[model samples]
Target: MKKYIAIVGSNSKKSTNRQLLEYMQHRYVNDVEIEIVEVAGLPIFKKTRDMAIPEQSKAMATKIDGADGVIIATPEYDHSIPAILSSALAWLSYGIHPLLDKPVLITGASFGSLGASRAQAQLRQILDSPEIKARVMPSSEFLLSHSLQAFNTDGLLIDAEQTKWLDSLVKDFAEFIDISAQLNHTHQEDDTRMADFSWDEGTTDKEVSK
Candidate 1:
């Protein structure tokens, strides 16, 4: 079964972005298993060259490393992503760099007309960092503007058009994850083959000295 991590950027329990992530988990949109990574308990990252990151945060990175893909639901804060999410990303950037080349899907919900598009773009920049290098899905953007109206009291999307878009996004994300994994595998195989070939062609030290 495909495994994924759904991350909500906001720290608030009543955050609409968090609600959206939870809704995705409840739906299991693409027949995949999801584990929601909560940002509330994470320690705010401090840039200290000497100190190791919080153990819990390190463990969170490890969880991300194990997942096949990540879904980041974010909220905008003055045309940018929330600080908690940025801090989490900072923590993930160092150490083992668990998010390196990982497949990712990004979405956001907000009360404004633009939803969280600007925040998502900022997030994409962070994900594109040299240490992170996350592979974001290029085509789909789930911008839930006027978020409260989009969902019903039961926490389900009410509009048929929006529902259809979500379904397609989830399906595309799943396929993207699979295809990326295959490509990584193929690259690894190629590297291994090249290494083996190089080893075979190398002369022994004794022969080289002669």
Candidate 2:
């Protein structure tokens, strides 16, 4: 069975984003294995003098590296991803690139009608940045609007159409993972270049001219 890491991109005790992933976990139990990961206890991102990465961050990166693909469920705050999720992504990228060329699927939920659309767009930019380089599924998005009423007591999606849409998207993601794996040659070259690049190193204009 193909395994995926589903990141709950929220720190709230009662986050609807978590609920969305949990629902996927249960609904797709037969089609795929989904392990839901939390981002609650990670320390806020900061630059250390020694450039040390926290053990917790390393552990999360390990999990991501082991998984076939990733699913990020985000919630919008002030039309952007919550600070906690951004911090978690920062930790994952600093000096380590587990997400480099990894396949990713993005989902978001919001209480209002917009359904975290802005946050998801911002997240795509972050994941596609040079440092992260996550291959997010193209032209695909799953947004749960009015999320407070979208689920039932059992944490299952109440709307049949929504469930059907999710089912199709998940299947597509599985195929996408397989296709991405076939491009390992390119992925390797990108990884090598990323490993050689560093944000801390830069040349002056004089050095560039020389």
Best by lDDT: 2
- Model 1: which ten-residue window has the lowest total lDDT? 192-201
What's the TM for model 2? 0.93
| Stretch of 10 with least lDDT, candidate 2 | 201-210
In candidate 1, stretches whose alpha carbon ends up further than 4 angstroms from where it belongs are: 185-210
lDDT of 1 by residue, 102-208 (tens): 89999999889998999999999899875567889886779999987888899988878877888899999989997887656444453344334321136665543
TM-score of each: 0.84, 0.93
Error of 2 at 155 (Å): 0.8
Candidates' lDDT values, in order?
0.81, 0.91
For model 2, name the residue pairs that clash.
Answer: none
